[model samples]
Target: MALLHRAELRPTKLELLAAWLPGRAWFGGEAGADLERVAAYRFDDPAGEVGIETLLVRAGAGPIHQVPLTYRGAPLDGAEPWLVGTCEHSVLGRRWVYDACGDPVYAAALASAILADTGQAEEYFEVDGRREGRAPSMAITVEGAHRADVPQIRSIDRVEDGDPVRIVTESVELAVVRRVGAHTDLPGSRLAGTWANQPTPLPLAYASLR
Candidate 1:
């Protein structure tokens, strides 16, 4: 479950992504003058220490871009290069954010979700310790799932320019589809999802490189 914060974030997510998106390998040309966040989803960290979120954004009227992100209290060890930027939270103070592709916590959660056939995390708002359910912007589904008992993630990398990040461990070669395709018709895809504003589900990623 994700605990929603009532406080505000300095330099909101969209602002940071706007500055960072152009340098990415998978970035298509600008669609318009303003970037808008179209859809969003989340994955839960069992430990409740890491914040995992997936954002689908459109630059004007361009193709929606999928960007997964991870938030941490401190710098992730050996992940200085993947840092997206730091921001001050109205409540949580300082947070170190990074591309989810490079985060072990994110890799583990994403891999487990695809392999086990899971969807987005349940969200809640904590008010003085009371939990209230929150709605998600997108829906998810797993196509063909195979269970992995404790699928260990050894390392992760970006093989090509952008999108389709590769996750490596001792078990499977999981490709996390950033920047989702028009349709999730990819063979061997373990998971797929539909944006709340979109009519059809699109392929998010596949796992089968053992």
Candidate 2:
């Protein structure tokens, strides 16, 4: 389960994305277009140190976009290039945000989801020491079977951020689709999801063992 705080964020998630998205090569919307949050889903980090969330957003009259992000208390070493920017959390103070494609924890989680069928995490609102169940804004399905062992991804071998953000490791290769609704028939296990305004499940990411 993932615990969520009701604290405020300085430069809300959309604000940060607005300033960063245009710079990405795969971003197809206007540079100054307003982005709307369609929906989101989270993946639990087994260690419980990092927060992994994927946001589905869209600009005016543009295609929905998929952006996977990771939140950390401190800067990720050697990840300066992938840094989206920093935001201050009311409850957690300073947060180091990065593109999930650069986070090993995200890579491991994605691989596990594809190869081991571990779906999205269950979320709860922590209020006054009590946990309240919170329904996920988005739902996902994994096209794979349950597995006992998944390769441990401690570091990333390469990251190629394009239309499909490619994360490569010694044991696996993952392609994170940047634009929603643009599904392709790719080999290997895949992860698909659906949200508001989108009823059909669309490919979000694909992974293959190396």
Candidate 3:
């Protein structure tokens, strides 16, 4: 299993966003804004070092937006072409870029994690979100590669508040939820409320990951 120290992971997260976010369609900025560390958490990865981080940032007069990101640092030399973007870290003084899900090892590890948590197979999972629209969102391709084994549903849940579901697979755990104001039905509606790990009486559903 590969895990990253919290210290090692945080700076890398900022470096990646600084490099990648400015180019994204959803990013509204002339240049990357200053990113502040709000809250962050970690996940396990059987294949490589995986870090899940959520950042709050103020960009060009827009309200604070939550930028969820994942990081892997296990020498993906040939995989550079698959990265979303790359930048030189002022601290690390090295270049870091976005993850590549097209790689089989990365994809398989992600699929295995989703299946272990949801009891669904790979072929049934579908990556659907407003951010994804017709094209699969970058996060989906990165975090959802292993979802091929899970059921195809609008979303998955482990809490009643409907915020988002966090699941652990192999060694990696991911916070799964729909983009705000994206889908109006099914799993999306289930996320309308805040998410809590404790128990609740909310009605939940399970669909194929097709």
Scored against the true structure, residue 102 in model 1 reaches a CA lDDT of: 77
Q: Rank the candidates by lDDT, best first.
A: 2, 1, 3
Model 3, which residues run further than 4 Å from truth?
A: 1-12, 29-32, 48-70, 74-78, 81-96, 100-181, 184-208
Q: What value does the lDDT take at residue 181 in candidate 2? A: 68
- For model 2, residues 75-122, the per-residue Cα lDDT tens digits are 999999989999999999999999999999999999998889888999
User: Any idea what lDDT model 2 has?
Assistant: 0.90
Q: Which has the better TM-score: candidate 1, or candidate 3?
A: 1
lDDT of 3 by residue, 1-210 (tens): 122222333345566666665654455544545754433322233433443333444455544334544444444556554465443444333434443232334333333444433221111122352121121111211212223334222222222222233332333333333223222344211211112231322212112232
For candidate 2, what is the TM-score?
0.96
Q: Report the alpha-carbon TM-score of model 3 versus the true structure.
A: 0.41
Tens digit of per-residue lDDT, candidate 1, span 178-204: 676743554454677776657677877
lDDT of 3: 0.35
How far in Å is the alpha carbon of 197 misplaced in model 2? 2.7
TM-score of each: 0.90, 0.96, 0.41
For each candidate, what is the lDDT? 0.77, 0.90, 0.35
lDDT of 2 at 47: 98
